[model samples]
Target: MTRWLGASEVAARTKSVMKTTLRSGTGRIHFLLRAWRPISSHTSPVDSSDIISAVSPKTLQKGGDNGNFKQDFMKLKQPRSSVTTVLQSGNSEAQRTSITKLRRVVKKLCKSKRFERALEVLMLMETQNKIRMSPADHALRLELTIKVHGLLKAEEHFNQLPNIASQKASSLLLLHGYVKEQNTEKAEAFMAKLKGLGLVVDPHLYNEMMKLYVATSQNEKVPLVIKDMKQNQILRNVLSYNLWMNACSELYGVGSVELVYEEMLSDKNVQVGWSTLSTLAKVYTQAGLVHKAFAALREAEKKLSSGNRLGYFFLITLYATLNDKEGVLRVWTASKAVSDRPTCANYMCILLCLVKLGDINEAEKIFKEWELDCRNYDIRVSNVLLGAYVRNGLLDQAESLHMHTLERGGTPNYKTWEILMEGCVRSQNLDRGINFLNNDFAGLKCHD
Candidate 1:
């Protein structure tokens, strides 16, 4: 007969025994087994009769009157087996749902810029071996790893992937990672390896290679990428042509840009966007082809709707570049008329153009008008006018405006002081300059 100890008595004795066993240099496993064993165990001092008395008749009958009490006690002691059985029954479905939820969470985390947590989720999924990662998933995980832990970790992850995941898309992602790290040699080598593998390299990959070259200021290598694209017979899109034009313009000059432009124009398959036209106009301006620049701008305008601020803004800037006063004013008027609400940027453009053209009186008048309606007072607008005044040797006007701005609780930036100091030196007014440095401009905070 086993005597069943009360719950409190059992707990206290178990704790004491565990402490004693641990201090005696016995292994913890022995204490744990002893502490957790049922009172019916042969080593326990409790009587079996106490346990038998506590058992209901139904339970005794279920175990059978022959009473294998130890077996019944063992069944009561281990509940984990039944719990594990229940857990294992629906495990596959639960695991599938968990994987699905984890993938969704990873995507959302990545979008929210929580890259570390996103990578942790991905690692958990990988360790669990419950989710089947597609090529895109592998690529995304590599990208996230690159962003969070850096390129070395991303490379390790990529290398650990199965051969099936080493497809063209995943390879492209790794190549992009190398490009981001500015490892030109590794990027080129990896790209070449991809080609050697007989992977059908797309135009985007070539574009990425070209972008890498451009970013590195290795402009000479850009045309080589285009040449490769041509040899591969990959059709050049507008983006490709633009990259070629930019590389050519930088290395060879406007003539090369023109040649590329002509080729792009003749290629009926490529649709010319406003960006293409803008690029052409800029290149023409750099080459001093004023009429050509105007023609490109006009064509850009034709493509845009009347209400398009971009077209109006571009027209004003190009005209200002050519010093076409009437054209700038005309385009500005047209923009203001069509725009429901003109932004500060639009007003700044017109003001900057007016100041650059040396129309000080008109700039002042426009500044006054803008001041009345402007919701935000940008110091940049004031700086433009101040710069014009200093350049034209109108130190008196600049000083007056500076003082007025200060009176109105406006803060002058570093450029403003520099301009005033320059004006003082230019005019040979050393005393006024010393005063400015000591008093007016003293303790001025410079913002970057």
Candidate 2:
């Protein structure tokens, strides 16, 4: 009898290990940093060009008489102790130039999504220079931490920030992290602490709190937060109003939604966008105001200019929720005509709608088309189709699709296996169930 760990259990264990690793490794400079030394008085000034040329592939390949590329490559890749020493030993102007070049390289790496290397460069700059980073720089590091590590590790890093680096920007980054994780309790506590410290609470922070409240199903707290924002003289933005209306639509009814919409229109700072109109349409549909909903959707479409794939996708989603299949197709077609090229996300939206409408054939067609053109494959799209097949009792199709995905070098995630296992169990296919279990065990062993 093999036992499989549930998703929650896996998540808990993963978080535990991450927290342990973060605590142990926090504030520890990379081993490579120890090798770096300030330049000596006897050494000549290290030119920026010298640094560049030293690491160049041509220089590495020419290191030996025999042109030993491997040895040269290894030397180039190894961190040079003299590199930092030379930078720090230079005159003020020379040092500034070196720092500037390093900063540019760091920025480029970050833009290219090479966050690990970016962080290493940042750490080297901070450790070697012994200069306090700007508040904005600290905030950037905080965001990068959240990106490279998970929220738990990010929060630990936030707590370790020096007092000077702990500004509103850093606080907001942590608050946003908590909101994203939907840790409402932690968000509220952090907010209270910030207020206790008499820190300036921006309108965006209040909006994030409202979002956290809404995400946690505590919609009643939203209006209270909005009122607090007003009392504090923080002008509400369009997103603030939309979140309020969404909460009201869920909690009160269409009447409350209309009142908020009216208030939003009156606010000088609030510029109602397509999201606002879409929110209204959703509320109207919920209240059984079918005609009003359609009108709102039309207004939303009118507001969107050409090449607005997201806006069109939103409209299609709203129509699909109302079971308007024709409306979904109409907007999707119109979107294709105007947009430069439909994104994977756009195709995903329409495929989901088709599946929801029980139009599996169309969904399959769209999925195949996306497969042909999508440069970056998304597993969620395949999972959606798999879900539809399983729900419709097309177990054979689901199994075939799963195998096909595996053959294409696509790794099936936990949800993929879960769905197949559930389908097998429900259909009383014992052999298939055993096969899925065996495959899952094999995957676990491979991971180990």
Candidate 3:
């Protein structure tokens, strides 16, 4: 008979086995596989694909995902080769005015992700006004800030620009700005504008903005959001329910979270997925309502057994949180049974978890596996491995990973600099770290 491991005993067992891999991008978390009693000794270590079937009597489909960013955001980068007109003959004042106008347009184009247009405007001014344009002037600072901090902060500064740029800023632009400010009033006002204009905010917008107000817990907006679905004729898609479900989980109980989901499920128009269920389950786990969480998982299993492999992962997370080693193993084995084609993220999570668990053997396996998987993902994966290696005191590996990141047409960000610098300091390799910062990072910042 399989050993029945209790919650309290999980930590003891996990002292040597519990692990969480820090994946590169996708949220696959490697955790303790509670039921996976490593039976290299057993002739059959419970078929992974079989247990997965036990959860759902449906079909099993295998696939892949974009390694770093979300699938919806993974367009490839293309280069532009247009030559610009130069403004070398204009007088100083005229040149400055022309350059300033060009600079404003450049910023506007950048905000719209129309980098080509911005560059074009800059070139046009340079060619016509006889003045030079510098991408260095607050361009990198603003660009980096927007990419790192996000569209919201960028919008504020973007909004201050001329009408052309402001017109280019979409609801995404405004929503991002509100999210960055983290100001409820601004967030609500912006959302209200979207609603007033008869536009339904996307799930992403609703979550970011709603998460802010959930703390107030007055939450009268709950029904209104649902009401907006009918009023505005949006079917309250999975993301819509998720934002509200997340809120209910925080303010009330799993019952509240389930209520919204249940309502959605009853509606023939609303289609939910395992991801939504997992997100809802997370709230229950966080609230210490494990029993209810389990029930929800079972429900998900029933609904999506033949659909997605996320069920096994959700169970792994739940068991990991509970410190249930056997349970974690069970889920891991089940997940693997469905497909061995793990994403870079899944490998990363497993690696981090093994590291945390001090299961170096498992961690090494994860690292090796991820090394192979990272090849397709380019710099993002390399950077993650570099950071992980540095944290684990593998200096050689970190250096190699850093070099690999550059080869993939991706520049290391400030976070990379800080992590490597700290790694160097710890290893007492100060000069090398300083050299990197001075020669590489500093030069990279020259554009700033």
Candidate topping TM-score: 2
lDDT of 3: 0.52
Q: What tens-digit string does per-residue lDDT give for candidate 3 at 82-136? A: 1121133234554444345445545655776755444434433433334443435
Indicate the residue-level lDDT of 197 in model 3.
57
lDDT of 1 by residue, 335-399 (tens): 77665677778778888998878788988987787778777666666777888888898877886
> Over the stretch 1-448, how does candidate 2's per-residue lDDT look in tens digits?
2233343443343443334434545434454377444432223443454342334433222222223322232233222332354244435554554455455555765887867655555655555554446676677777877887677877786777777446666888889989988988889898988887766456788888988988899999999988888888888898899899999988899999999999988998768888899999988988889999999998897777685677889999999998888889888877876747787678878998999888999889888987888776666678889988888888778867865665454555667767877776767766756754653544533332
| Per-residue error (Å), model 1, residue 441 | 7.5
- The better candidate by lDDT, 1 or 3, is 1
- Give the residue spans of candidate 1 off by over 4 A: 1-183, 196-200, 212-219, 250-256, 305-316, 329-350, 361-378, 400-412, 427-448
Best-to-worst TM-score order: 2, 1, 3
Better structure of 2 and 3 per TM-score: 2
Listed in order, each prediction's TM-score against the native is 0.59, 0.70, 0.46
